[model samples]
Target: MMFRKKFVLFFGFVLFVTVAGAQDRYFTKTGKINFTSKAPMEDIEGKNKTVTAVLDTKSGALQFSVQMKSFEFEKALMQQHFNENYVESDKYPDAVFKGVIANNAAVNYAKEGTYTVNVKGKLTLHNVTKDVDVPGTIKVNGGKIEASSAFNVLLSDFRISIPSAVKEKVSNSIRITVETKLDPLKG
Candidate 1:
């Protein structure tokens, strides 16, 4: 009958949509990023919890965006100097990374497991972009994907300069750690 054929077609369309949506993408708005600077005179640390990240599960593509002013430091003066002088947040408001997982075939997204992979991307900070390859871990647990990485960024690479007066208080390289729990994108 015509009604029976129409019902079958509608059911097939819905099933196709559901399957396509399941593998679409994953994203998070409240990711966490931390940076630390260690020197003989002092240790400086800052944290930003307002980072946004997206991962395309079907293509192994990953991207992140972080506002420079969102980073909170322990000392108010240090934070002020960081934005106004070092990072120049007014000119370069956000830092971004866009790239893909190099070893995508090793991980099974449907199954629950932790996989170590290499991420090659362009990191843009303080108006400078650099290509970097870093080791990261992707953990799939309970239908959620958690991606994390720890890496070092050199100040000179981003054109960040340290004042001579406080040169001893800061490190030339900063240690950065990123962690995010991503959920499937909903339509």
Candidate 2:
């Protein structure tokens, strides 16, 4: 009888841990972010594929971190000016967003479907942080979750300024797109 009780208790504990570990958290390291600026004279774009992100499906919490200098531009001069004059990557090497999903309960993680969610968070870039609420989609397919969103950010909001010499070549408003496939974090 004692051995039976111990076996049941141990099995229950293992089951509890397995359920807890499989449901709550998701993470990704090779996320991708793209930013584009369209102006009268130029269309500039930068892509970065080294983003790190985490999501807690149970608590609606989401976070992202990326290196500022990781963005790659098509032209060398534009990339140089972007890091040196605009974002100042040396001083602010990282950009982070920490926020929560406003209506996280609407998404049924157990089901395979797409859910639209509103993410409310603070975006920090170039040493400045601002409140941001964006619409994002979470697609759950084959037990995999794909998160994607696109939003526009003003350069001046992050203390990023374009020099007068190249002001016409760059737009003050930049559109950023984020994409990532998160994997279940298992212990």
Candidate 3:
């Protein structure tokens, strides 16, 4: 009985370690987003701050979330209108993305290389969710991981209504870029 109990405890400890090492989560303090729209009069470019992402490497899954309230435009009036009317950031403060990496190939995180990843996930903005396919590059080097992606999203798909007054200022399609750093799982 004593031997059996010892063996069970040892096995349980090993199992815990194995499972704990499988999933890791990370976040970056500086993440950015860019937007562009063309009108008959002028072309506009805007940027946003405050993006966060969580990654589960063992499961090959990732989730990225951004606060819509953090989006900034050059013009104060434009920014205020964006938050209040267009994006409704006060109501839907966040845009979340949850998806899995489609590639079956295992990534050896210890090596230095770039891997192409097919990301399929749901992107939610303005309380609307749409399926998006974003192709990105993941680089693992010297215990550090870097990920980058650029994708286009249609504003109308997210039910973001544009007022006639500022229709020309905002574009129908928004281009998004993500840059993040990955850290190892902590104890």
Candidate 4:
């Protein structure tokens, strides 16, 4: 009887750990990120739908990565200039953000509601990394979490140089928007 009792306790502990680990992480592959450049000559915009993001609900840790080349611009020439001249996608293939939700404790992930949170992290672009704190919303509904945020990025901060000839066509700052629907990570 004692041996059977020990075996049952061990099995119970294993089950608890498995369930806890399963509920800690969430991920998404089809995240979308869009950016808009408002200049005097024209408004330039691009969208990338192949972003990958991961969130740890337990720790409020979040990270995302997007390929610079994956961004699609309406004008092919604009896209070419962006990749070759501005961002240099060939040299810097990906842009990434790794950060945590600053107000994680205020968010109750077990309940369904929308929570406004400030995310503090480092954004790497054009081979430059900068610390950023941006306000964003996290919505928990039916076991899924949706996160969205919009922020502006300065080109000079990332060391992206705009040519004197076309500087008027592109703005010094760009508006960026990110959205993702994350499901629980599967074992």
lDDT of each: 0.94, 0.94, 0.76, 0.95
Poorest lDDT segment (10 consecutive residues) of candidate 1: 17-26
Candidate achieving higher TM-score, 2 or 3: 2
Candidate 4 per-residue C-alpha lDDT over 22-110 given as tens digits, one digit per residue, 9 for 90 to 100: 98889999999999999999999999998999999888999999999999998999899989999999999999999999999999999
- Candidate 4 residue runs with Cα over 4 Å from true position: none
Best lDDT goes to which candidate? 4
Candidate 3, residues 1-187, lDDT tens digits: the string is: 9999999999999989776774355456566766766666566666766677767776678887888777778888877877888788778898888998777255655579998888888888888888888898889877678878888888789888778877766778877777777766564
Candidate 2 ranges beyond 4 A from true positions: 3-7
Task: Sort the predicted structures by TM-score, highest score first.
Answer: 4, 2, 1, 3
- How close to the true structure is residue 100 of candidate 2, measured as C-alpha lDDT? 98
Candidate 4, run of 10 with poorest lDDT = 19-28
Q: Give the TM-score of candidate 3.
A: 0.83
Q: What is the clash count of model 2?
A: 0
State how far residue 118 of model 2 sits from its true place (Å).
Answer: 0.4
Can you write out model 2's per-residue Cα lDDT over 1-187, one digit (the tens) per residue? 9999999999999999888977689989999999999999989999999999999999989999999899999899989988999999999999999999999999998899999999999999999999999999999999889999999999999989888988899999999999999999886
Model 1 alpha-carbon drift over 4 Å, by segment:
2-11
lDDT, candidate 1, at 127: 95
